[model samples]
Target: DLHNRFKRGARSYTGTCKDEETQMVYKKGQSWLRPALRSNRVEFCRCDNGYPRCHSTPVQSLTNDCFTGNGTLYRGIQSRTESGNSCLKWNSPRLILKTYTAWKKNAHDLGLGSHNFCRNPDNDRKPWCYVLKDNLETWEYCDVPKCSTCGLRQYKESQFRIKGGFFADITSHPWQAAITTLDRRSPGKTHFLCGGILIDSCWVLSAAHCFQERYKVHEIRVVLGSTYREKKEEDEQVFEVEKYIIHEKFVSETFDNDIALLHLKPKADSLQCAQETKSVRTVCLPDAGLQLADWTECELSGYGKHEENSPFYSERLKEGHVRLYPSSRCTSRHLFNKTVTENMLCAGDTRSGGKEGNLHDACQGDSGGPLVCMKDNRMHLIGIISWGIGCGEKDVPGVYTKVINYLKWIEDKRRL
Candidate 1:
């Protein structure tokens, strides 16, 4: 009955909201437990002090994966099982009798609000819930990462060097990823479309223009830990794309905001898409305030063409060394009068080689790959391969999507 009353969307905008359990005005960030129907079953929306809306910030967000002991107090809004199945509501008639019995017994402590949020009813490893499949009900655990394992990676030091982009090993640039599309005509054949970088286990960063054709998610795959452009290494990890996010303000004509994110689909048995290995790891996101000196050399890797006119993508991954250009020279006039927004940066080999000299730079198919600079003995992503003129042309710098500007945007979109 109380649940039904909550379902009716009751509201009280003028009263001093009090904690249903403590019978006192809610302190900042305190979750308002439910009161009986006598109080009209109206949930306290917020506290006047302005901490997020009531229970809006999950307890886990305040601390680690589990808020406190056994996570009984975890108020996260995760509504899916570890296997990506939607969780059945505690009060749903579809829940099996046995599970429903337990839920009914400890519905309050289980953190089963009027919604189907995951919770630790019996103090198992973490929160869990039941799901219905094939006309039968079963329980499954939720994806609650342990504190120690979150954003963990082995940062490898780069011995920066490149001559017209030297052939590189995946071990040296483990975060390098390839975004490929399956051929509709050939069925099993996948073509390397663009380069990407592993930012998280289930997230890959790439260029937005690569998806201008709007290929279906099922038609795309992200390949990591592979050194060869097309060959599948024994240790390589492959994942289908769950979805992609291209910036809302992206302009195809000017190539502004040329960044995109690919969400990797987890395996059926595990919530993780990419596993950490010798040749697979995530590159760190740079701090918002980070600024490398002008002329500071950075590294980029991809399976793009070796030269501007090359008909084939490189058979092996290649790494290029380029220096950051000064704000004065990195302008529209310097780049064929192209629209260089604040979201873009310029980098290229500053070496003044004669007519026969080869300059180091990103090529055609390298869009969406990482441009990382070394700091604190770790590689920090600074930019994404966006657009460039002819490959390795002296005095002509390649343009990239400046990642620092989107730090908050990336974090917010990933949360959603």
Candidate 2:
């Protein structure tokens, strides 16, 4: 094997360090030489006649931010802790003998033979390794992301996605729900009305304003695990709304208390409405005490129209970054004197909107979508898309139902 074929050892070159002014003569030619620089880093190398050299191609595993099945199959080369400490070599005598013991038990399966790559040999919360922090060998967790964790996603970027916002895959915002209504004009067809968030297995959160038409329960359908606005993927889960409850205090005239919940009908022969998958999972609800600083950057996603004038909703999902606005700026005066109640918060693209004037904000079809913020490396649902003066208008932020204010109400209502 290459490991045994390459003998890693210290070099013993007899060549003397040269100065820049010194002329070095070789069989091919002679030229002025520079002094050799020394590095304090320890590296593996093969020696040829007392000269250190790399003779083999480096074998690297595909990088992944998250893992599956206890991370035994994780082959990532992440060699640092969350706090930026270098991982101790798994084969280091000090680590194997003093700090770590699982290497000997599960080396082959865990890929912990000689490399210092981060792995979860013992199945802890995540892959971790021993580090020499402050001269003491202590264990610290690595920075691997959880694949199935709510509010976390594998975001992939590419060109030609969206104009105002980046094109996003559903896996990045797995909790996104497409609330549709049976089209009265076309039989067996549905139309996208508003966006929703999958808060739990059997419940979805949306805006009370979306249901103001008072459609029949059988006419509403909630589609999850989808990335396209109209197309459905093989993994998509379609559910009929069993029942819906709008806030009793919701006033459609001013869009106050604009929050609603829909109970998903269970799948046939099963009590669950959705099965957790990589592209389908529930988002974590923020606690009643959760509070983020003003201007904290958060994310919003939907298949909403690209802009106010766009007659069509986005063919694919799109995500936009926004900052939580200060309460003073999120007041009634800012939103054309519309009632900006205490239960409402505001967020929008705070950029000055240069010549392009392309600011990232929610659009026409994004109502009831999620406004999630990253906390403790996990995503927490913070707001629900309520209303906006216009899509991505300069200095005009989009208003949302402050989710934290309705946590208890949701808990009490979902139980029914």
Candidate 3:
């Protein structure tokens, strides 16, 4: 049926030609050629108008042309034309080459596509491609396909752990309890230092002068999340330090850049647990543009020695509420006028009926803790415990390293 239909659907190509000298009429495929061409399925000839014609005359036309070359096959012609031209376009090759070259010149401009191609595979290694996002406005390591041959990335603000400290549940108040300790020597034993805030899983920032050359980084142990002094013995988590970074500009004589960051040897467990709680956290630095005057009331807490000669150790951490003194009042204090630079902030009342009226202020070991300000019912870090003439002295105020001054440095260090 198919073959009969194909035969019936065949087309004819008729053409005319003249015997040159005699001018006698002649047909290219008149009668005899028509039947032969139709049987073989060849349909290529010249028309009366002198134009070439190729048509399907029979079901076997394609097969006959493949064997005898009697018809002009479209597919064969296209293949021959393409092959002769070397499969090339006049301008397309140059255009494609230029685009690829441009992409190679500035892979960073390709954005995410570039990152996808050059990511580091090793968990310990750094990323190869650097990406700049608009939100952060800084170049960051790209996270993409893993490549083993990548450089290591360094961070300014690295995480460190503090050993020999117990965990305390301060979630109720959001205010971390600060502890102060007196310098006491124990026979054949290491003296327990003041309590410190765990700012990160690995690093602890504290007052520079607290530990002297005798206090080696690895020797010192950090205790996290414990409130009672005796409780620290039985129920505390501790980590040893690998190294300590004292501020380059820290002045021991005057206690200027009074901050030291401790790098822990082993990383602390970030997971939270019942007995070994991981509630310790770091406070965000204050915005530089925000004025300190906007903050009024502030609170400070610690486990420092209650009295200079007191033998009794406080079982629980103590907290004190203080107010930020005006800059004018802070500048008027003795010795503080020259010591308290603009970078430092003073918190405590010197006027009559002040919240810290006749109360002892932060002492040794309280350095590097937070002077927290309450704003919009949220606790904001305003100052770092720095120094003062004496703990809780009359007409004297607790000076803190203003967190605002370190905002840019902190952000730059923490960028991933």
Candidate 4:
């Protein structure tokens, strides 16, 4: 392969490289590997302790890097280092199409609809939404209005309108995951301890309390792309945990900052966890500065319990809808003697009285599940079901860790 030859000191490998996953192709006109037609430069933007190891800049900040015939940076934007090679900036645009004509021509190559939207990418344009990638980069095309492509499907967030106590469709919520013990509970067995949300191909978000047992990397199992609780569906994807990162300031007493992240080990040496499919995908993290209004009706799903006193958790996946409660009403004073910091919020059926008029809520085994809400036609995870007084109480609503509050924290952890 070209990569192998390059590893052996080949100056460059030319021809074409196709992305096996997306079926997108990259071509070159030189002996060395060139950036693909619609592709941007790919580099690991490695970071440590929440800081980028390399500071990217507009190629103007780079030395000896010249502009291309079109007056743009030869390879878009790049920053030079002692290594003498300048790679494109992660924040840089892959290509710039000045007119709609240029845009239509390129979109044709990718089979993307030319009538989709403007060919120009998002830059200097703030109000108009753009396609945001999980790697903290925007796509070259300005076609997508939001993070809709992040993990979207034909089913809108309000579609199916259904998980808290019934059998979930085989692919109701693709981002849902089950974090369980990796056969450590018993010699040949494992047990579900908590729920998780897939935020990226290699990352999962959960509650820190779930890892209190200090499960070893090999002792954690993450099941995705399926809805059955115990059945191993043919489409299900299983992964081992490479590592788990618990928030450093997580407090057990109040469950403050109780979020955690799971790094998934691939299925094979060349396999990438959480492959995209009609039945598998990642959830979009709300934009950093995004603030969703309170009282917004949000949906949460899990394989928890139908009732608080259920003898066992649900045998199948379930989903429930809960509206966000204002912080004024979601304080510790409203609940059974507990601290409800700003980091946490409350949600549940605001309706009076029981059973019939009452709505569903996440219960016991649902800890660490996702409370996602629809935004601009895309699903964005807004909260994590942390805890509550009891299951679907009339006056007592369920408490959740406000996901928007921790967006920056989570981004710093995985935006490598």
Best model number under lDDT: 2
When summed lDDT is taken over every stretch of 10 residues in candidate 4, the lowest stretch is 68-77
Off by over 4 Å in 3: 1-189, 233-235, 267-279, 308-313, 332-338, 350-360, 410-416
Which residue segments of model 2 deviate by more than 4 Å? 1-148, 155-161, 353-357
Candidate 4, residues 164-232, lDDT tens digits: the string is: 334565366788898888564368588888999999888999998888878778878888876767878
Instruction: List candidate 4 stretches off by more than 4 Å.
Output: 1-148, 156-166, 353-358
Q: lDDT for each of the candidates?
A: 0.76, 0.77, 0.45, 0.64
Clashing pairs in 1: none
Q: Cα deviation of 62 in candidate 3 (Å)? A: 65
Question: What TM-score does prediction 2 earn?
Answer: 0.65
The digit string of per-residue lDDT tens for model 2 on 267-345 reads: 8888778777878888889977988999999999998999889999998989999999999999988989888889899
Ranking by lDDT: 2, 1, 4, 3
* Candidate 1 error regions (>4 Å): 1-163, 354-357
**Which candidate's TM-score is highest?**
2
Error of 1 at 216 (Å): 0.6
Query: Any idea how many clashes model 1 has?
Result: 0
RMSD of each: 11.9, 13.5, 26.7, 15.4
Q: Taking the tens digit of each residue's C-alpha lDDT, what string does model 1 give over 1-416? A: 44453343233334434333322343444454333344333333445443324322333234433443346767655567778988777767666365543247545545653456677877775788787878788888876544322223444445434447788888888899999999999989999999999988899999999999999999999999998988779989999999999998899999898889899999998877898787888888988899899999998889888787779888888888889998888899998888888999999988776232378889988989989988877788999999987888889899999999999888988998
Per-model TM-score, in order, reads 0.64, 0.65, 0.50, 0.64
